[model samples]
Target: MTFPAFVDLLRQLYVNVAEHEFALPDKQQTDSRVSLLTGVHRKEVSRLRGAGAPVRVVPDSVSRTSAIVARWLADPQFVDARGTPLPLARTSEAGEPSFAGLVESVTRDLRPRAVLDDWLDRKLVEIDDEDRIVLMEGAMVPRGDGEVRLYYFARNLGDHAAASVENVLADAPPFLERAVHYDGLSEELARSLEAYSREIAVETLLRLNKYANQAIQNDPGGSSRWNWGVYILTSDATSLVAEETPENKNAGGETA
Candidate 1:
């Protein structure tokens, strides 16, 4: 029989147990119920049960339906006789999205530097691979002993397209220090950088969208731009002056 038919039979059995307030049928009775509900041979039910088909029983008549529903809900591998996982309602945490916990779990098991480097490499490829640009200067600045400051730059022939490339750089993860500095005035090179810049702008806008969505869910009037904050550090006695570049300016056009 078709998979859907098998599933229907299993569901009917569940409903029957729910309404009748009785234990699920024994093996022989189960086979008979399958044959009656799905028009499949009793032998088919026996075979499926041997192959790990889950059969649950209600222990108490007073709350039989609730008990059966709860059992089905708790079992991650609970499938119908046809072998489809039953859909269950999902509950999200107060401050976390559905996949946030999974992401954190995976990241926690990885080396921080390795993860950062790998993600940066992917972003670089998206920005430069097709345009034949070569990444020239790249470094992961050590922030004390455990943190890093990632920086990279690439160069290409003056005429490459700029849109998608720019987006990759701008939308890169927040840990990276990103900028596009012009090296020469050739028309082809300038066009490529322009494309890179535009793409980065697009990526930034997408990041803003994510931040805005989070803000709305967290606080009704929270500012989307407030989703991220900046920190500035300086040496106590150095004579160095940090000037903000027009292109690298954040929301306030100031150095951080």
Candidate 2:
């Protein structure tokens, strides 16, 4: 199957895991995790894995699979559709940020778009979230160190909410070098970020969606209403209102 198609299948598996907390099947199982999740044949899954196609596997079996799906949700390709690579996200050698950390920073700060632009400017990292969910996959490499890689998945918190989360991340602790970034971001980096991000977003969104659905269900009747309308006022909107009534006039009989 095509790479994009494979990525989509992996995404569905991630959603299933997030919604149900589905444990991956053990290696001893007759069917591979991919087949069980996608109804694809185990042999096909094996072939794909051998061919460097990303396959889903148990955490314990990650090393065994040649082409395992990333644990996070970020797409690690630094290049855009036009093949333009984005700027990197690291600020200092000791603070080389992985794609995962960048996502965390964006989520924490709530300014994903700005962060994306910031990443573009650095030309060291690349991010893509055009999908229903945001996926950030990339790598980081300190000048003297090996590459550190990352994968991340984030919910599409609308433009406004994402911006808010980005603001939070900006103030959070920096990503540690020992964690993921060993080399500059690469394709391997993309896979890793995608895997990680998918897992987190799926779990978080499921809970949120459940609560929202429950709220709607509990308020099925038309008894509740909220006032959220916007009103356009005249230029002197505040000045139009008198502070005091005629009965409460000042000693001079002037309105307060």
How well does candidate 1 match the true structure, expressed as C-alpha RMSD? 27.2
Q: How many steric clashes between backbone atoms does each model show?
A: 12, 60
How many clashes does the backbone of model 2 have?
60
Angstrom error of the Cα, residue 90, model 2: value is 13
Query: lDDT per model, in order?
Result: 0.35, 0.36
lDDT of 1 by residue, 88-116 (tens): 21223464222222223334554434433
Off by over 4 Å in 2: 1-27, 32-34, 48-150, 154-256
**Candidate whose lDDT is highest:** 2
**TM-score result, candidate 1:** 0.19
Backbone steric clashes in candidate 1, count? 12
